[model samples]
Target: MNDPSGPDRPPAARPRVRSDLDGLPLFRGRAAQSGMIRLDCNESPLAPPAAVQAALTGAVQGLNRYPDNAAADLTARLAERHGVPPAALSLGPGSVGLCAQLIQIACAAGDEVLIPWRSFEVYPSLAGTAGAVVRRVPLTAGHALDLPAMAAAITDRTRLVFVCSPNNPTGTSVSRADVERFLAAVPPDVLVVLDEAYAEFTGRQADPLDGFALVREQLRQGRTNVVALRTFSKAYGLAGLRIGYCLSAPPVAELLGRVAVPYAVGTLAQRAAAAALECEPEVRERCRHLVEERERVRAALLDSGWDVPVSGANFLWLPAGPAAEPLAAHCREQRILVKAFVGEGVRVTVGTAAENDAFLAAASRFARTEAAAPVRSAALG
Candidate 1:
């Protein structure tokens, strides 16, 4: 008899995966390499406040039990804090996870998800994973989202639109008035997701868009298609814990909850976020310092002849054009890391003053070297 388990037997057919996913671009946030001054990911340079740390310590004792799938206590606390009913909130691993769920609930196959080009990299990936067509509207010449262009691009099949305030990698935002005007032009059936991952850093910016306030206004107006995503990752120093909440109409929030990964928000994350809310003064102070640093860094880059845009976030975008990768490599040589978008630009987070100073030093040196190369080439010619 033939040996059924022998090497001669045909290899078991590989499990099938969605072939469309093969075309999806891998998400690419660099991890902190050893001994590098990491400013690549837009994570808070400071750790969580003492109260939050204590909460995490206490929460560790209950790891044997599954987290509350509904995150009831945390939801109630967040509802009270935001002055929204608990029914209007949905918890997820991060705002990014909520983003995926938003795409899931809104899009069927071939439906469209509109986003600003180069806004958040994950938007396309999430939409594509849900079998939706990704539509990108380009940013304006000044690197801000072109809200009018995005509004014009929407078709009836457009199920969701992501408006990332203080857009990732660019550090530019849409003003409240501009967003309101754009919303007026949007079809009432299309969902608008205001991604406010860096909202705390925008307090000092002139005429900043308050996403939570906008969501509340939409709800009061009986529009159920607008949603706001907030995270504890940035200003609250809970990036590792991965807790975020969505503010939406009660029906939308319920839909998000229905599709969310059960218990994705852990016990420690919930407790830590609750403790973080109690330490609002400390979080505010930290954000204040980061904003100041962000402005200072932008000024320094401008003074050094780099055309840095005015940012409402805790990072600066250096539109390095073709030299983006080389500039990033130069910083790495000095043991500093920044997120580079290849031919597009580089995003450097506002870290502690010393860290910023070191990056500034590296950046200055790279600028001088870059400036000299063309001159030398001209002389050679």
Candidate 2:
């Protein structure tokens, strides 16, 4: 009975601004296509050792019972491994969740969190969703972190700074000296989160920044402003379990736990993670294998005169640029799924020995095509 031209109803209220999402595909799932080599995500190519399997079987006995809410025992073992007190650690579903939680606790609308461009895709997205302004800095010319520029980017509004050592996608790392300089430059008020998810593969015996040691020193200085985020997912080969831990001051640890979902570190996850921790020898050996393969893959690419960057993570970063899409397409056509950077190039994870061989074949073919193109003429002319 009412007029058809009557004023339209107002739209329903929605979240005004999602943290750094800015229309980015933060949760895009991988496509399920046949012949997929599956090197998209940075997961360990190896499976958890047999001891871990047995431990998981034991936990199945308690499937009906709830997990240890405190995660105290696991946290204790983690603390001992790092030589810190149990009160200084907190576990999470994974290191990624802890990153999200840290932002939620410290960041508010208009506040800024500093991160790197061409690094972990999650940082900006998480910061944006947590209501913080994301300040994205470009990596240095060599693909390493631009610590100086990052320090310069910090302002009074900056609350958190995330440094992904052996950065994702690019596989470059900031040196210990650079990190020390960066820390010295940033204001003491800003909290620094050193994400060491791939640290185990770096092969640096006295780990740069020695995040564990740094956390302890920072806390002793009455600084509640530093944290080292590590995971059992990568080196421990338990990515499916999704267990990670943080080393920070107790107050900060407690704050993170408060913001964390109750029982997020699941029963199975905790037990499996604990079991994995006990097998340092096996875990270390696997990491050593990955490091070895990373070199083998890099050598083959370099011998072909491919302009591959020096990478330390369980992946390699290639220079695709204009050919990026086409190169990725070529690999995809052959049923190999690698992580493609629309803005940069392709990131190929160092998969199992067999998978690496397949990727190398694809890459070599692409390189030959590139070599035969007008690119040579343009460069010479």
Candidate 3:
């Protein structure tokens, strides 16, 4: 119930907005600039492939026409690709946007939504919008979602649980076995949202769980509470277009559609996403390169004396403890921007080779400064 807007609201404007809206935390990544290496947001370093570019250009000609609110082409394509009926799919502006809609579909005032702390930054805001109580379960010591703990935290009021696999920022993925165990323990009526936004980058990791596959299996078994959320933002490089989809039981998918805004997804996004699907080989290649860069960057960070986690996504977690902000500041000073969680840690995205090298240089400088500061203070003492 903490206010994201703090206590500075003008008295006149306070009553105009819902109490819940007054304190909703907004994402605050730094603006992109020329010559700056953005290692903050977990976005793909590559642009959409030539096919998408062509589709986008052609699609621009139809700007005067309204978009397909159903997102027919994209949804059908996704359904066909995943071998699921179109009824089980729900499309939206992006996975984050769909997360909000899903919350609206399942939760009401006084309900509760359980989320892993330090997972996706948007979870709290999404829950808050629905006037749901936010329950943040802390991650395990290994920076993984403690599924057992999360299951333990559930109550009669818990209506939804968000499980971000290959979890954002932390970059640790949940295995199929772990997910199976967690699902078995949770209440069958309570919806579990498995966010696999980073799944494409997780293929090289050990036994990465296919979230949609799990959802489909659950649906086949008549378990309708599981939903899988995915996006074209990361691996597909369609962040600007804002296209994402959800796989769920037909009933849940229907509810999601009810809460979604009509024509929210633009035409360009749908066309681009379909075109991106057509260029699957290109997407796979980009992911392959990013995974390689992720390993190289992670190894470099570890060698540099940082406690970088073994990541299954396109980013690395530097658990800098108290030095998190200081290190982030140092990186920014070196013209590199990384996502910092204040006292928690920093999430550095794996950009292109040159961008990664730039971040490495910044990190090296920060390490040297940190190393020398204590010695200098001791000498003075």
Candidate 4:
């Protein structure tokens, strides 16, 4: 069979990927499309604000020219919002993109990057790509990140730690006190990234813990290693545009900028993000609406006997354990898509009212079907 194309048929052997990558899984999630209620990616179910739409419309005319590589306007607007100097900001294609760049800036081969297990799916693979070894500490019994365990795992090799507050999938946030203690315990040389991609949702909470404020306070107290990550993708409804930025000490922000790809944040994305910021009050109101919907959805699930977490983000986590896949499949059959971790759980983003109602109906059906099924041992007997 090989002889049919001669000795060169196979071409040169493709260069092998790094050995460390052999078993690591890549980031996998559902993409946006028409005619489906996408509750898998934790995206905002709302449309972008009017101002953002207008900005993007105008930005299209500027496509002939290169985007502002520095993204100065967006950065300055974000700086003012976060009460940081413009020099303390760095923009990227997305917060996840910045996560990869941050690893590159702070880590080398054999350096350690620590993150919580069952957190954002991107951290492990991205850190690996940056030549850093990843260490995953398990979440606590309550499904919150085990910050104490993470602090205990830090070694001389540990150069970076990611704290995904209102963590993905599980949707639980770490308390400010806990994070502050964890930061205090860790070596000052190690960078602690407080990823607050879902911070806006927490504002309506009974006792709000602001990740940006936490970072600012720590920096004010002279802890320069802490950084806060945010995005326009969630609350701002700009997931399609892929714009996010980080707030950090000036020196660290400079390093982050160095690793950034030139023109990574396009003109449309930058303008849209800036415009989104201008609609902060409106955005907060949208977040509050989502929060209300989230609580309602969780209550319905709880009433239905499903164990759901208290989500700080605009999603619900159903720890279905071995039944996770079956439940997810059931939802798919009903035309609803949710993110499922095989053998662990399902994460369903809170969608519009009608979408949530449809999902609830499907969930009810699934529960009924499960209840009506015969017990395995009894049936066998």
Q: Give TM-scores for every candidate, taking all chains together and pairing residue i with residue i.
A: 0.95, 0.91, 0.93, 0.93
**Model 1 spans with C-alpha error above 4 angstroms:** 1-9, 371-381
- Where does candidate 2 clash, by residue pair? 19-128, 19-129, 20-128
**lDDT per model vs. reference:** 0.90, 0.83, 0.88, 0.86
Tell me the deviation in Å of residue 295 in model 4: 0.4
Error of 4 at 317 (Å): 0.3
Model 2 TM-score is 0.91
Name the regions of candidate 4 deviating beyond 4 angstroms.
1-10, 31-33, 203-207, 371-381
- Candidate 3 vs 4: which has more lDDT: 3
Residue pairs with backbone atoms closer than 3 Å in model 3 (clashes): 4-23, 93-242
TM-score of 3: 0.93
| Full-model lDDT, candidate 4 | 0.86
Q: Candidate 3 deviates by what RMSD?
A: 5.6
Candidate 2 lDDT for residue 167: 91
* Tens digit per residue, CA lDDT, model 1, 69-126: 9898989999999999999999999899999999999999999999998888889899
- Please give the range of 10 consecutive residues that has the lowest summed lDDT in model 4: 371-380
Q: Between candidates 2 and 4, name the one with more favorable TM-score.
A: 4
